[model samples]
Target: MHCFKEKICLIQIATDKEAHLIDPFEIKAAPFFIRVLESSDVMTVFHGADFDIRTLDREYQARVKNLFDTEIACRFLGVRERGLGALLKKHFNVDANKKFQAFQCGCQ
Candidate 1:
């Protein structure tokens, strides 16, 4: 992980076999994360949120208000699968062909 304080850029370089290339400049300029933090009326939503929240908190000292967890929402809605891809497919008929699904397990 790399962070540039001057630019407020936080980056992660995946060195694993299925390493993904991300542009830190693009991420730094993306408005979604910061905009969600700054919004008073719009609540930040997440699914399987623990790690995400921790990273955002550590990196930006961001405090999320009115957080809605999709997994929890799925439970409330009685959905069979709470995984993001599964839920997306079931609800929105969207298919995400994830290439790095096993990247975290070092499986590449």
Candidate 2:
């Protein structure tokens, strides 16, 4: 159960009103989100969702429905640079924040 040892530290959700940063460790109700992820009516968009999808299944038994992966879409659309930062920059003229990329989550 190597995957069980791993935990999702951050779950960011953005709505028209505001953005939410949920710390799974603090929430302790991560499984509550499984229903939302599994709902076919709700579409979840991710830049690259392979790891996230696998992790959700392994950790909470969540099988996401109506998933739209931007990376895959970009590839299908013939965008050469598929990275999130690159795509955002090219299309929206905005820089993707990588500030927390180096932050340690203590999973290992």
Candidate 3:
């Protein structure tokens, strides 16, 4: 899940059945989706998230009651390896390709 400013530009939502991308540029899912996200019962998950969470509160005027931050959990567990890439390799033996990380928002 990634966002630019207050609006989420790209979101990858998944379940046991399937997964889909909600591109606000192409779809009008923000208003409804933001309501769902603001629900106290809904737990939002993120990996090493920081500003995104703050932006949701500051810009979107929304609050997430339950948040599962992988980095925070790792810190709680006292794990020396905290990066998502390192954790994936350590636990699941998967290598994450960080190709899209270098891309800037609105970049061609």
Cα error, residue 76 of model 3, in Å, equals 0.6
Worst 10 residues of 3 by lDDT: 1-10
Q: Please identify which of the two predictions, 2 or 3, would achieve the higher TM-score against the true structure.
A: 2
Segments of candidate 1 deviating more than 4 angstroms: 1-35, 100-108
Native RMSD of candidate 3 (Å): 4.0
lDDT of 3: 0.74
What lDDT is obtained when candidate 1 is compared to the true structure? 0.63
Rank order by TM-score, top first? Answer: 2, 3, 1
Q: What's the TM for model 2?
A: 0.85
Error of 3 at 74 (Å): 0.5
In terms of lDDT, the poorest run of 10 residues in model 1 is 1-10
Candidate that scores best on lDDT:
2
lDDT (10s digit) by residue, model 2, range 1-108: 243345677888876789888988778667668888888988899989999899888878899999999999988999999999998899899999999764667545
Better candidate by TM-score, 1 or 3: 3
TM-score of each model, in listed order: 0.58, 0.85, 0.77
Please state the error at residue 18 of candidate 2 in Å. 2.9
In candidate 1, which residue pairs get closer than 3 Å at backbone N, Cα or C atoms, i.e. clash? none
lDDT ranking, best first? 2, 3, 1
Cα-based lDDT at residue 4, candidate 1: 32
